[model samples]
Target: MDNIRHRHITSFQSGYDPVLEPIVFDEKRKTKKPFRISSIKLKNTLAPALATIRNFYNKYYNIIHPLSFTFLSFLTRFYLISLSDVVMWDESHFGKFASHYLNRVFYFDVHPPLGKMMVALAGLLAGYDGSFNFESGTRYPEDLNYTFMRMFMASFGVLMVPLAYFTSIELGFSKHAVILVTLMVLFDTAYLCISRFILLDAMLLFFTFMTIFCMTKFHNQKCDPFSANWWRWLIMTGISIGCVSSVKWIGLFTTALVGLYTIEDLWNKLGDLSIPKIDYLKHWVARIICLIVLPILIYIGCFAIHFAILTHSGPGDSQMSSLFQAGLIGNDFAENPLELAYGSRITLKNTGFGGGLLHSHVEEYPGGSGQQQVTCYHHEDINNDWIVLKPREIEIYDNETDVDVEFVNNGDTIRLLHLGTERNLHSHEVPAPLTRAHWEVSCYGNDTNGDEKDYWVIEAVDDIYKKTNRIRSLSTSIRFRHKVLGCYLRAANIGLPDWGFRQVEVTCDKRNNPKDIFTHWNIERHWNSRLPPGGKANYKSKFLRDFWNLNVAMYNANNALVADPDGFDILTSKPRQWPILEVGLRMCNWASDLIKFYLLGNPAVWWSGTVSLIMFILTLFCYLVRRQRQYNDFSPVQWTYFLYVGRICLIGWLLHYLPFYIMGRVTYLHHYFPALYFSILMAGFLMDHFTASCSLKTKNIIFSIHYALIITIFWYFKDTAYGVYSPNIELRGKKWLNTWDIVD
Candidate 1:
């Protein structure tokens, strides 16, 4: 097949161009001829019947192509979609989020809300009661229904195949190229595996594919400016971008592609000779409204819905501010307000790197300071609450608020009286458990009567220079500057073992060092009379402010996660290894070995796609340097449009990829699936373009064989992705690469 020769030069754009009538040899016939796709007889003798047969396939391919795409996509993605009843792999993380959504509990995720919200809705519709914990390794509860959730995402995953078909069509690929991409996605085991689980990849891939499809369709509609379908496609493109953005920040790559394309379109319109300069405003206004303004509004709306639904506090509260928690229902300070006084009970929240409430329990971390562990807790436990007292007081309560209230002020040496343990928040010269360079913070047995080392100067972090600084409620972030240790209080993001209840470690960071963010503390739930009193609902009054604050907080937390000792995720994969299908993840195991789902892609498709990418680059270089000039008259208009579509695909791939190489956060192989859509389509275009001289019979046979082989690869790796119990062996004895790690 690789040795198939180019036929004689007889037709350029089907004989319209006479420039490239140069004679070439047909190695099969040893006769001179031009490049053509028909049978050998057509070169010597023009036959009407042969021409009709070739034209029939081209004309009817549009109708028949979908049948093939649907068969493969539906059969694989839908087949045993619920093969694994248990939540597998990263399902623990996303499934837990869905459960939180079902319970109307406010929580946070690194991703935007739409995808998980859809999963929660799917579970709810499927009769799930929002009761299961979805903890890792736990069997799915008897009454809980997860089939619908898996099926919903699987169906979304299947749509990606058809969307790829249309996207390839818009890129001017031949029917063979379109079918290749469709089958590539449909039979790829990774998609089948990830999509059938309670995962976010399905919604992400679907929206991303549709975004490119809508973009191409919109670009094609340029001839009819502002026409109904043109506007519809344009709006749909923006909506698709918004939808994907709501799934993950990876969607930003798609957003960037659209922005670039819109700019290019506007540039072309500005330079067009036919369109008057005054009328160019239409293009500018339309692009801005649909591409920029619409996407921004939709993105904000997604977060708004996310915030609106999660009204009650849940696991994610630990990462938020004390004032932010005040807005959530069931939080104590929401109704049972506290006050500011020398003897008032209080809880001080650390606003530093590891944001958590300063907490202590009855136990000590192993091999660390003998004092009780001082850690950070996400929730407001009784252990987290503390009493405020002067350095030498007896830790006695003074409840009379009518008299002149003695407010703890700056420069006043004080100790944090642990309300539950009667211990004070004390720091000594001993090193911290995690960040050993820092001093240890723990609960010492004595509070009001504690020694000088327990004394700390509590000043507002933002107002530390002001001599009159005092602890403020609902308005200030504070810093605990140790008097004796000469260090500022800080929290290490890392957690101790079960000995410390797996809570964040609180320590003393040196004051002179600049990385002092972890030392800033805020009186999150403090009760005080420094200002006017307000209702608990006042937390909702600062919605927009809280939104920005929460976004920044979440961003920093996720970004800094890698720096945490225990934060590195097991499933993390480097960006470079994704496209080659270099590794596989074992997703599930059973007590009885009934089913085991492994996440891996089809080696043939992935491996070929990798090689095809290399080939496409070479072809592109050849086109620019040689082929474009050699065939300058080869359907000039059509070739220009085809290259434009191909360029968009290339850009889309780069947008979704390349960014991963630079991101600091943990990523997985599934993140590259969006980019794979473009890589496969681009390769398909070059394959068909280069093989245009081959007989249709040969091309069809090659594609059919390629399609069947991938399906066979799917069958061999079926147990790996489908979670069926089967003996482990390489399928077809064709394990071309050891990296596939195909168990069965």
Candidate 2:
């Protein structure tokens, strides 16, 4: 009765007529008691509980979500890791490299040494003895402990999710967006399958993730520049950059992304008038020391360790400089004579980076001039040896050295007697097997008998030591010019037909380019019994020179991996085909009885990410057009955040991806994995941005649907990556796209 009277008095005071207010209040109180009491009780009961739950989610989602995803990633990544127990895809290549490391035998590969060293370390820790060759499709030996090696590698893949999660948080992603990013990486089928193998791609992907994470962390530290956390993250970013680049040259694309970010950062800082000039100078110095100097040291340090471990000479000895080879434990380069003379038996190595030794075998070319095949070989053999002698027309050849001991001089006409074939190195007007513009070089006539066509004038270009105009072992850069045809002997890295054993074609190039290193030759193995042996000092290799030479060789070798025109590679793919998930690589033998794995990305994740990227471009265009008309849709901070996420994800994807289309090297679907990561991040960004205006309930509903969709798609395709247990016939409808070869 008192409450009703108070409510009536308050209602009358709030501009209702006193009499009407009392009547209305009495009627409402009598008629609405059950409804009003229940409503009040329900509100009182639910509001506090909802607030508590929301507060807990907001406070702990970062911690709980990352931990949850990490646990889930471990399950996804480590499952069935040892299912096949057979060498698959690039495992055959990288595993052999790991063996080379454990055996301490020098081997040359196109990639940098750090990733292989880590693989070797894993093998060493696993008790592997470096005995198995890891041939493709070969079952692992019972004692090899390959499962342990793979588990070690898979650990890197497992951490990628948490790294991406933290990186998104540092980039200021909303809570829901963070979840999306983590899920996309955690459930990607290709990443899951590739990570479970003993391969370098996992390590490469790991360091790439680390670098981006460090970059974002470092970027956030800019507000308090030069703080301890700032310096720590800055140094970490540098270390990550060095490590990623050490895995593979493809890692350089990630480094380039960091570089672009830094450039933009410094440029923005330059425009700030409030920053003191000295402070700005310090900024420059800090970045230079951390980003440039530190990474180079790390890179050089990897090589230094690589050089220390691989002290024994192996098949890769011939790929290095003669001086570098001489330092190897089992190499005979230290025993060779120092000088070149008329009767010296020598191997002529092309001075071009990654070039091979001039060699001739008894086999003749099936087409072109029918003579003993002369080619360039990477390995050392007796067939690579040639005797330097006076031209046949100039003097009668003898089996023994002349008593006068004539030294080979520059511009002297000479005949190269192939020691293994007993034939003279000769070139004629006939076209080469592959390089038709140049004359074919072959071994013609017996050592005791040769014609004027065999005559080659030795042209001294420059010496490596800058000490001599005369020919010398491992130092002089000389060229051989066919005296009769005036063509320069060269190895342009062109391959010959099957009949010529597919060795590098040796041609007498009609075009004489003085700077062409292919035309330059050095005597790598000199053998003159009369001459004294060169001491170790003459064969000393400088680190800088060796480093430069090895990098150039790696570049040349990597560039040579283009698809052979006459061959077809079913496993190969195109850049355009990758983003759409148009194809996948068959990772192992597909026999019905064999447990095979197909490397394909989850279709939902890939297709959605690609669509998001396209939408981002259109959305940005619309926003800019609206802004131009002064229709301010976003606040200044919101606009900056939008551009920041766009630049990082969009620019990163372009950097890692567009280069593949421009690259001449043969590409596979796995090559797009790194770029796909950025696309996933971009998708998360767009999803969060577009839903920002929605009510909290609506947003949760959408996120739940998306999460369920990704999980369902991942489950459906899990067998493809996990391993095809049943026959291929059971997977008929699994192929969502016509281009997917999953069924077969």
Candidate 3:
């Protein structure tokens, strides 16, 4: 039978009909399994389910990952959002600004008004009455709905993750790269910590993200310029720029990024012969309208709303021009005398930006001749008032003097007698406490016993309207030149030591620069028995002027926030130390019992990002050198993608960060948060570049490993942002870097 079957198989192979041949089965064959799935059967079983899942994913995949990120972000940011019952670092200040808004009281800040307005709106929705002062370390009242306010702020932070994902998608990042971006942002401890509080950082960061997102979104529309989606994204980009800038001046860095992108885009367009002159001109017009005009309008509109809301006088009145203060509901500047005269009791406000009222106290200076301390005070005080007297006056004038009315003229010698101390304003050739080159200004001698050094020759400076020789209260800008030393009296916003009351130092600048606004002064409050009251006629202030003045003042004041050379600021971090995570900020008191939030980034995320930045620079250099050597490492499309994405990320990071190094003001770790975002995107780009050729399985494995590492590190440092409830030994062990002040 075996031989027959073999012959038949051979005959069949030779194309012979072999139906008559008999076949035989081997007796040693194993029995078939009772239950088993065949390959065909398995494929058939899963086909429909797999098809359904694929269809659903294809239909909603765009929303799925971003939504997942958003949910995770909400979990991280909103967890224990109200953990602390006391005020934190910036909340003490920003919360008070918000309260000023709720109370409709005018106030000043170094930053723009929109962020504080948002906090106020949040607090209002949370049923807060704006009664709490939000003093530093003050316990929040039980009735305060602080949680809702925090949640509102955290909402911006939560949206940041989705924004990162979307921005990554717009930048043409691969699916795996996008996932990495979202995960990195979601688990960032600094971003998480800053958002879960009543601060402007979260808002500033959100708008910054929006600006970059809108910019990339608009970039993708270059092929379909002037289309509906293009216009939408263009307008949105402008709005985002405006919103971000309205939050803080730092937002201008992102604005600069967008501006550079636009300039490059237009420059390329300019060289394109395919584009018509008319069409190119339209492009210019569109950018001007949306990017330039629109943002300016939005920024001005925010100030309009701010001014409209804060109609009552408050602590910020002194920061504005007297005319602006007179417009407030509860200010007495409108009732003051119009003309300055001898024997008038007045407060001389420094005309410099962020300047204060000319003030003196009975306390003597610990250094610098030990005379009565003359300083610039921000708030109203009896010590701020001075009695205007004749140069030869030997006696202090009474409150109601019978002296004849004599209007002050330019270059007239006069005496300023401190009403509270009865001492004449005197300056000698002694170094000021803070400014060594300037002479020490102090209140010396009784009002009846001042010498020639007490004489100040008041000279009229340029007024807002025009030149003026005769001094008018609240309208004239005047400078006092010391008769003996010839130094102009100045207040450069330099603060004195504790013994000098921490008020701004009033010095007589030795330099004879006539244009020094720091030496300028104006009478804010004028009282005389002879002169008539000044009405609201000349006291009217234009919004544009006030806006410009306030912004300049803010700029000056912000720059004045330099770290004291004699003192160490533990919370301050240098710009160079920020990217490397060399230091962390203590966001609150670090007592064992109080819940603490430390502003430190996740090590895996921050260090990885820093490495990626260096790698990107090195890789770009190598690529350029290789290309110059006739090596074609990338195709045209691939090269374009590489350079485009690389430039945006690299330049964005530099633009946001490099300025901090040049800035005179003190910086903190949080200042680096905006720039960290750009670095994170660059990291995602680098990840994409490395994994572009990897198989799906390999890519999945790499992504999974990264995800695990990020999550683990975030978990280890989670207590930093989520609030450390109590001191623990385990917490100290988590401090991988010695520079990190993670524990007491």
Better-scoring candidate (lDDT), 1 or 2 = 2
Models 1 onward score TM values of 0.78, 0.89, 0.88
Model 3 alpha-carbon drift over 4 Å, by segment: 1-43, 363-373, 393-404, 427-453, 464-469, 482-487, 497-499, 509-514, 564-568
Query: Which runs in model 2 stand beyond 4 Å of their true positions?
Result: 1-58, 362-373, 393-404, 428-437, 447-451, 462-466, 484-486, 510-513, 535-537
Model 1 poorest ten-residue lDDT run: 460-469
- Give every collision pair in model 2: none
What is the per-residue lDDT of model 2 for residues 458-574, given as tens digits with 9 covering 90 to 100? 999987665675787787788999999999999977877677787899999988888998999988998877778887777777788788878889998888899978988889999
Full-model lDDT, candidate 1: 0.75
lDDT of 1 by residue, 416-496 (tens): 888888988888888898788888888886753567887788755553212245555545656778988788888756766
Q: List the residue pairs that clash in candidate 3.
A: none
Which prediction has the highest TM-score against the true structure?
Answer: 2
Instruction: Provide the overall lDDT of each model, using Cα atoms, as 2-decimal numbers.
Output: 0.75, 0.88, 0.88
- The deviation in Å at residue 483 for candidate 3 is 4.7
Better of 1 and 3 by lDDT: 3
* Cα RMSD to the true fold for all candidates: 12.2, 9.4, 8.9
* Predicted candidate 3 versus true structure: per-residue lDDT over 251-306, tens digit per residue: 99999999999999999999999999999999999999999999999899999999
